[model samples]
Target: MELFAVEIRTPQWQPMILWYTSALNMKAAVRSVEDGYALLAGRGWRLSLLELQEDEPRDRSAISLALEVENLSAVRERIESLLMEPSAPIETSDEGFLQWTTTDPDGNRIKLFQFVAVD
Candidate 1:
């Protein structure tokens, strides 16, 4: 599985991003999240806010964009090799939720989600 280099950048004025994993319908994608969040919530998408505070962040924001990786293990290794400041424990999840973090640079919160092979 090749890692994707996709990155998202927010406008200069608007500085914040709220991410929620959408309940994907595709077959291959849902393999990890078996029986998808059934008991607690139905099959739409559950969203939880990250470290979002109103108390005047820096002149800049926390994160600029995210990086989707091939797997959790690889992503973890790649992040470590980069020698960047880790924000918090990579929100670990077995359902391929996401391994997220914020870098020291601009205190930008970046996310790397494990993705399945397509095609």
Candidate 2:
């Protein structure tokens, strides 16, 4: 089965939308402020954010999303330019994957990785 989208609930919708758009360099494929929902599409993946009520607890630590990119350096530069710090230093895994982790405004862990062929 093909995965179409992943949905997240956040107390802050507008800022979350802006964060995803800027971080991923993607635009919302579907957005409805009145309905409290936004769907962001990038690199064939869909990220949907739904508005959460004030009473709802927001704990994003349990949700970690990993994205594979072609240019790890470029993505790192973009993240640095945004003035946000990564959760840890970037390192190459034993499996030859260059990876790092960062959190969004709501504290959702985002893992960025790229496959590096070792000569």
Candidate 3:
């Protein structure tokens, strides 16, 4: 047997969303989030915007998903590249996982986590 290839495959949730309050406000949420998507797209990140139910008490809070390319730097760059610069700068988790949180046009928190590369 021989090695074929390895690459960041699927996304794994390294850390859960730590916020207690749900950032709501749809119209404004999309408006701001759209800016995020446009910036990511510009960076060659194919963004998949999804409406999904969050976990626990925050379940009621709306969420905007960003499924981008599986490169840590790429993921971080696309997010940081945003003109708005997010509420906070991109950060790496204790586990060396890169993470970033932004708000949509409304106020819904949009979290971006990169996938691990593996074959």
Question: Please, what is the whole-model Cα lDDT of each candidate in the order they appear?
Answer: 0.41, 0.77, 0.37
The runs of at least 3 residues in candidate 2 whose Cα sits more than 4 Å from the true structure, single-residue gaps closed, are 57-119
Off by over 4 Å in 1: 1-53, 56-63, 84-87, 93-96, 104-106, 115-119
Could you give me the TM-score of model 2 versus the true structure?
A: 0.47
Residue 48 lDDT, candidate 3, scale 0-100: 28
Against the hidden true structure, what lDDT does model 3 obtain?
A: 0.37
lDDT of 3 at 52: 26
Query: Would you list the clashing residue pairs of candidate 2?
Result: none
Q: What ordering of candidates by TM-score runs from best to worst?
A: 2, 1, 3
- Give stretches of model 3 more than 4 Å off: 1-61, 64-68, 79-87, 115-119
lDDT of 3 by residue, 1-119 (tens): 11111111112211111110122211211212322211112122222233222442343225455443356466556556663643566666654445566665565555665544333
